[model samples]
Target: MDWGQIFNSTAGWLFSPTTIAYALAATGLAVHFGYAGLLNFGMAGFMAIGAYGYAISILTFGLPWWAAMFVSILGAVVFALILGIPTLRLRADYLAIVTIAAAEIVRLLFTTQVFDEYTNSADGLSGYHQGFRDANPFPEGTYGFGPWTYNQNELWVRVFGVILLAIAVLAVWLLMRSPWGRVLKGIREDEDAVRALGKNVFSFKMQALIIGGIMGALGGVVFALPSAVVPATYTTSLTFFIWTILLLGGAATVFGPALGALIFWVIMAFLDNVLPAMAAVGWLPMTPIQAGTLRFILVGVALMLLVAFRPQGILGNKRELTFVK
Candidate 1:
């Protein structure tokens, strides 16, 4: 087995665009499920809208990069409002049903031929990041050492992504400390009690939904940096992955989701790289493809163990846990 290659692959995931994207998405889920007690099983829909919104705006309208990003966040907010208006009043399971279905609808809409001109359908979109890339300040040379180096563009992406992630974490931290945040936690604990105390529970829930959806949209934009806006990327599995990150880190904790994302990706990356190398050298008795699949099986088993032993997650407070009665 090539130990150097294995180490490089595993370490590369530390600043990978996928890691940043999942971190942001998990943070958003923490807001919805952790703070607001919302069962939002369709975070992928918000991400899809954000991705398609930015791609289509740049492709068809020729908008500036900043304008396109703003539009994407606005689109996610509007989508959240649409989803929240009729469904927030229903039972949690109903919200889950609507959200998951809505995500699928968004994915199919992007893949439909009628919107091919704007979305490029299943072919996806490119050339939209020229403006984004033009702003890179790093010189064209490799940076970092020992299993963690990147070219100018790659470094630029990671730097910008980390900046965005930091800002998001700080913003969430501040929000969770405010009076509004207190109300959100109260609502999470018991909406009826919050309502009896004269809080606008529905309005608060809608606002939380919008905020969280915007975060997911931002994640979608960053996620598309290293790749094109493929509709297939926003499948139900995407949401499930975000949930896993949230659960892994500790729900209701400000930094749990981000930490969870880092750990989850790191573990997966290690398994992916190491297991394949082992198989290649006959140290493992599996084919390359089987080794790849085996990583996920291992991750699934790990998650089961985590749920069984630490239901509150790495940083979650058991007192904050609330399952619907």
Candidate 2:
């Protein structure tokens, strides 16, 4: 077992575009489920829209990168309205069921053959990232040390992802500190109480949904960075992973999601290498394939333990409003 390999792999996650994307998505989850008392189990749908919207805009209409981004945001807005208009007035559990179903529907729609010309059916979309690459300002060279290093193209994706994640975290922090943020918290605690005080609970919920969905959409774009947007990539498992990230970090805290993202990926990366190495060295009773599966089992057990011991998360305050729905 090579300890050096494990550490290098962990460090590689520090600059991982996927890490940045998950952090942003988790932050968006924090906004919806943690702060707004909405049970949004379909964030994956929003992310799929973001990536697919951007891809379709660029591929079908020859849109620029900025315009593609705009189309993505618009798609998220429309999705939020569609999902929220009827369900926001019903039980929160209804929203959860609707969202999870909606996410699957979106993924399936992309997989259908009817729009093969536009969506490419199950083959997914590629060659849409030229605009992003064209905007890269970095010089042609390798950067970083050992396995943590990347060439200019890869570095550009990481840089773009990091900048977007930073902007998202800052925006969430500012919003949660304002009066509007207070109302969100209030709704989370008890929407009836807020409604009695003349606040439009449904409207507030819709706004939060749209804002959080837009953030998830941005996260989707980052997740597609340096890679193609495949229909299978936006699975419901992705939403659960984002939830784990949000819960691991303090869901209501500003920096918790980002920090949790770093910890989660770094730990996963370390386990990926270390467990396989241990299996190969006969230190573990399992084969390399089994070790790969064991890592997730371990992470799941760890998450369960955290939930029992620190329900508020690493940075969450015991007094802060939590997601009870």
Candidate 3:
């Protein structure tokens, strides 16, 4: 039960690439539900397409990183269009139903044996990061301060992830302040009113869907940067986790989701470390397996308290924005 060890582990998440990736995905979710009021519950699917599309493009098609990234983006755009075309004009719940089903469908397809040659049949894809690695700016060495240090590759991913998150936050912030963003928020508040003002509500929803899906796809690429792309990684639980991150931060505001992502991971890290230590020290009457499960149970209780006390979240203001309906 070393306090220093737990602190180091918890602090590492402050600049974690995975956390940054989740932040980016949550930011996309913010754009979808916060600003656009679209019930897109399948962000995991978009992320899956992005990860698999990029990986397959590199491993199967022999494409470079840039080309592979483009392929992933294309895949996301096509997914958004397909998901939105038949449902954008209908009630928002339909989009949610379609997105959740579509996400599961994508996951199952990857898990099936039919596309084992391409998708590897749930074993996932890897060994395609060389092109991006060859472009690393940092020399081969450990970097950063104590308790926050990382190898050159890890540092590269962090630098790249932060730059991407900054660009996304800037883009979302700027977009939310523009005329188009205004309409999206207006639609969120009252779509029929925006429709009465002669704006094509369906068109705006489609645009938001595509933009958010592309962001999720890009986030997916970042998420799968250091690891293999597994179907299990793109589960409905992941989407729910992103939603929790979005709500933990300010949903309607830019950067909130990323901040929320950071906080969420930090809390989880703390629980992961502290709970095990407590169990080891006999402070908690629990086995190793029980300790692992307890962390999430504690997180659930904390979330319930947060929702009950401050549903607006850390950076969120105006409780009305928390209501999706």
Error of 2 at 139 (Å): 1.6
For model 3, the stretches where C-alpha displacement exceeds 4 angstroms are 319-325
Q: Clashing residue pairs in candidate 1, if any?
A: none
As for candidate 2, its clashing pairs are: none
Q: Write the per-residue lDDT of candidate 1 for residues 1-325, one digit (tens) a residue.
A: 7778788889889889999988988888889999999999999999888888887888899998889999999999999988999999988888899999999998999999998888888988877888888889988899998767788888888888888788888988999999999999999998999999999999999999999999899899889886699888999999988988998999898899999999999999999888877788888898987898898889888888887788689998888878522
Query: Candidate 2: lDDT of 106?
Result: 95
TM-score of each predicted structure versus truth: 0.96, 0.97, 0.97
**Residue 264 displacement in candidate 1 (angstroms):** 0.6
Q: Residue 132 CA error for candidate 3 (Å)? A: 0.6
State the RMSD for candidate 2.
1.5
lDDT by residue (tens digit), candidate 2, 1-325: 6787788778888879899989988888888987887889899999999999999999999999889999999999999999899888878788889899999999999999999999998999999989988898999899877977899989999988988888988989899999999999999888889999999999999999999999999999988867899999889989888888888998888899998998999888888888888899998998998998898899899889888888788899867855422
**47 in model 1: Cα distance from truth in Å?**
1.1
